[model samples]
Target: MRVAIVGAGLMGAQIGCEYALGGHEVRLHARDLRRAQQRVDEGFALVDRHALFTADEVRAAAARVSTAADPGDAASGADLLVESLPEDLELKTAVLRAALAEAPEAHVATNTSSLSIAAIGEAIGSPERTVGTHYLNPPLLMPPVEVIGGERTAPETVELARKTLIALGKLPVVVRRDVPGFVWNRLQFALVRECAWLVEHGVASAEDVDVVMREGLARRWRRVGPLRAVALGGIDTWNRSGRGIVPDLSNARELPDLATVAITEGNVSDDAGARDAALARELREERALGAAR
Candidate 1:
């Protein structure tokens, strides 16, 4: 298999390296060549230090991965095309349109976390070939890659993406629709919204909130989903109990003032840039460890 990945940043490089390790030829494209090379170098370093493969295997994978000299050249002869561009809808759409224009026969995928897959596919004018392939961060080790089908996405295209993820040893979930944030973020953000409200309303401090989620809710939800947790004649109880709280749940149309103040007070791990990186790394490490088990 030949794979072309746009955006050779952290996520892109990790995903490309995974394909290379899976015996697929991978070409990573970037607007900035120096940055792309730096990421590729980091990928090789990770391959060398990784516990999953031998020196010989890492060398083989390194040989299979390469950076494209020009961005346009990346999609020239690819079997699968991946867009891991910035979160901006316009930027992602433009890149996908140009890349898909050059590789009409290639299966197209966007690693978008929130943007609507159907909207992006409409912008690309190739919805049938395009599907959302949201690779969770630390793509090299993460197991789940949320897969969503656009309004016009063909069933075969979705299956091709599933097969592609499986080939790379990834767990892929077929999202029922091309909704924003797909399945994961929808559930995740719903929890986050309430967590914020709980903090603001003085119900719990941040750390205690963490304790409750970590020791109680997460411990249970980690194994059985919420619906499954209530499956054994508990649905009636849930329905009766849930209705009372449903109206009182957080319904903020914008970010809570407390959230803004937390960040303003240096709460992204303590500030925006470093905090985000640290949190992302921690989550990635946790997911990687869980996947290993």
Candidate 2:
């Protein structure tokens, strides 16, 4: 399969590399030539460490990667088109419109973390051909890809996306409904908002809270969700424990009602950028080392 990844940022590069590793021809497109070249260099460097390909092999694999300044040119001859643009509705809509216009024959997938898939599809004027393939950070390492279907998304399109993602060596979780934030963000934000409330109230130190989660809850969470974990601990005990455990939000301050405000206020975590890049590099190295073994 020939895959075209629009956007050569962290997610785009990681996903493009994964497709290449899966033996598909991959091309990375960027609006900026320098960024595109930089991404290509980074991709090779990361893939080389995984030793999935030697320097020469990486070069050969990367040879399949071409950069395009124009969206239409980038999407030409693509079987699958993945858009990894910024998490802005307007920006994504514009990009999707251009991509759909350019690659009318290709299956379109958005790597949107929280946007509405239906809205995105509508913007592109082809709801049936559009689906959401939301990947966790560092796509090369994350096994689960949420295959989200919008209200207008055709069943066949969703299935094709699922099959294609599996063929690219990813585990795809099909989501029947296309809700905002989807499943992952809703679950994650629920916990995070509570954690923020806890921190704001000084109920537990950050380190301690992290310790309790990683050392205590995370181990069990791997096998079961919070509800099931509590159920296994005895539903009676869980019910009793929940009686007085309501999170206190008196001290919680609203950063801003809108996400744009929160970002402008710089309340968003700084670690996300470093963490994304580091994970990609680390995963590449790990894969390379594992291949050597």
Worst 10-residue lDDT window for candidate 2 reads: 254-263
Which 10 consecutive residues of model 1 have the lowest summed lDDT? 260-269
What's the TM-score of each model vs. the native?
0.84, 0.81
lDDT of 1 by residue, 1-293 (tens): 88999888899988888888899999888878788878877766755654455788888988887787555688878989988888988988777667766788888888999998888888878888889999876676557999999989999999999998987778999999777789888887888888888888898887788779879998888679788988954888989988999989999876575553242333543443453444446556765897899
Q: Candidate 2 — what's its lDDT?
A: 0.76
Q: Which candidate number maximizes TM-score?
A: 1
lDDT of 2 by residue, 28-104 (tens): 77888787778767767856754545677677677777778777777888888899999888887777677667778
Best by lDDT: 1
Q: What Cα-based lDDT does every candidate model obtain?
A: 0.80, 0.76
Question: Any runs in candidate 1 off by more than 4 Å, and if so which?
Answer: 44-50, 257-293
C-alpha RMSD values across all candidates:
4.3, 4.8
- Quote model 2's TM-score: 0.81
Clash count (model 1, backbone only): 2
